[model samples]
Target: MDGLNWNDVRDLARRVAQGEPLLLTAVTRSILLRVAPQVGIAPGNAERALQSGATAEELLQEVSRRISNGSRRLSRTLADVERCRVAGDIDGARQLLNDVLAVEVVPHYQDILRANLAALDDES
Candidate 1:
């Protein structure tokens, strides 16, 4: 989250767009591993795809989709969390944060979820 590098993402996309073969060179592998999680695609999932002969184009498309959907999902879920808290349903709010944290792989989103959960704890 702290050292987010959009240049890496753009480079990957450029390679894919140019129809470059996705050879698992050390540099390529590092980019794939690092950018995957930052964009909300789980690292394990990306690794599996890469190992299973997925093209860079295919992976890029999937990352794009995940980034879009993940943004909406986080926003909606956070809204629900706020609703629960406003309704005096602390347990419900905690549960919502916990649920997000369970599947959230992005460090920034995980931090947000954890912070919300901690706020609920403070209120208690």
Candidate 2:
């Protein structure tokens, strides 16, 4: 149920859309919770899909659209960070980075954020 709430859904969608990890444990659990039973659709098959690299669209309806919007938010956040940095506002950049980091991201993106924060540190 981790990815069911609006904020968590959006965050999960962002991570999934970014292709961070399709085989997330939380995702599989979320899919299991959100997926309604279909006529003649095997539970095993659905479980398989959840285990496999199924996209949010594949797992649940309207999730893909939510994921798309979440992707846009992610992109806009990144752009905002760049814009603030470009404007030479180190505090602003740090604030933006902190806000982004407050959300859940896969480990690699976390590294990129650490790097960003480090670069910000080097700026001031």
Candidate 3:
């Protein structure tokens, strides 16, 4: 929650605006809880979205697409994080790679993610 970023809030707002059910992973949920007060959206709203059975993956994809298109590196980072590991844990060398992506712009981030994924494939 302490590390909650503005991108998370923007994504939550977009989901609310789209009438998309909130599919919050635990980390995402924590971010939302911290941001709810600032956005004027209640924590209950996110809970309700979860209760309504929204697919978090779908919502995350939507957010990623929007962010990617908008040239926001943070969105790309989130997507990379989501795809790179399950349940949000990017350990070992992957974690180091993600840290680099986290500060990049979208265009650069996309290239980096693609390269990283390819490297992973090469390893496999």
Write the residue-wise lDDT of candidate 2 on 1-124 in tens digits: 2232345545655676787665557745555445322212245655665655544336543444434544565577678889998998889989987887676233334456678889889888
Could you estimate the TM-score for every candidate?
Answer: 0.63, 0.43, 0.28
Per-candidate Cα lDDT values, in order, are 0.75, 0.57, 0.53
- Which regions of candidate 1 deviate over 4 angstroms? 5-34, 40-54
Residue 39 displacement in candidate 3 (angstroms)? 0.6
The weakest ten consecutive residues by lDDT in model 2 span 32-41
Best by TM-score: 1
Q: Report the Cα lDDT for residue 6, model 3.
A: 57
Candidate ranking (lDDT, best to worst):
1, 2, 3
Query: lDDT of candidate 3 vs native?
Result: 0.53
Ranking by TM-score: 1, 2, 3
Quote model 2's TM-score.
0.43
